[model samples]
Target: GPRSESGALDAQPWSAAAVAEATSAGRPVLVNLTADWCVTCKINERAALSSPRVAQAVKQANAVYLVGDWTRRDDAITRELQAHGRSGVPLYLVYRPGRAEPDILPQLLTEGVVIDALKP
Candidate 1:
């Protein structure tokens, strides 16, 4: 289990296989696509994703957290961005159990927003 700089939770590196496995097992997944130079990403990490309430919510939901760092050129991350119709970093997606599509969160986040998204 890997934690982000904000120490929000144990976030594993993003991988399609891992995400698929979690989804197939009826587990919630939170995917964070960010870059080192992205200010908004940093803000979200510190303001919302790192909140203790958010961490508790994630744990209570038994969710899997995955982070995709776009600090460099990564084909997999590029593909994901393209698939999601984006060309930049700071993408937040929450996949719930049995859901085919994930909930795309806003660029600016708050503790309440993250907590609400984690709700069933």
Candidate 2:
């Protein structure tokens, strides 16, 4: 089971093993790449994170929410962002655990948009 609050999906961290588990279970994963001081990221958290629809989807899917912290400038993550062609925080990716590809979400998030995406 996922150890998180009903609406605190973004507040949690993800391990590679957890992501693998979700994929192995045929579930989707939600990856939120953000720093501590990104305004857009905070808004996304407030808007989408608190939405009941999103919370329900997360609870039901047991989605692996990967939050990569870039506040301190980690070289590994820097390489990842560069590889992805992204140079900023608040990057979101929804991937199927075992799947190599991820359906990436933009930095801006709306409740309806997230809910629609989470529907299976």
lDDT of 1 by residue, 1-120 (tens): 246465868888888888899989988998889988999999888888888888999999899989988999588999988888998888888998787888988888898887889888
TM-score of 2: 0.79
Residue range with the least summed lDDT across 10 consecutive positions in model 1: 1-10
At residue 55, candidate 1 shows an lDDT of 92
* Candidate 2 weakest ten by summed lDDT: 1-10
The runs of at least 3 residues in candidate 2 whose Cα sits more than 4 Å from the true structure, single-residue gaps closed, are 1-7, 15-17
TM-score of each: 0.93, 0.79
Give the per-residue Cα lDDT of candidate 2 at 36. 69
Best by TM-score: 1
After superposing candidate 1 on the true structure, give the runs of residues whose Cα lies further than 4 Å from its correct spot: 1-4
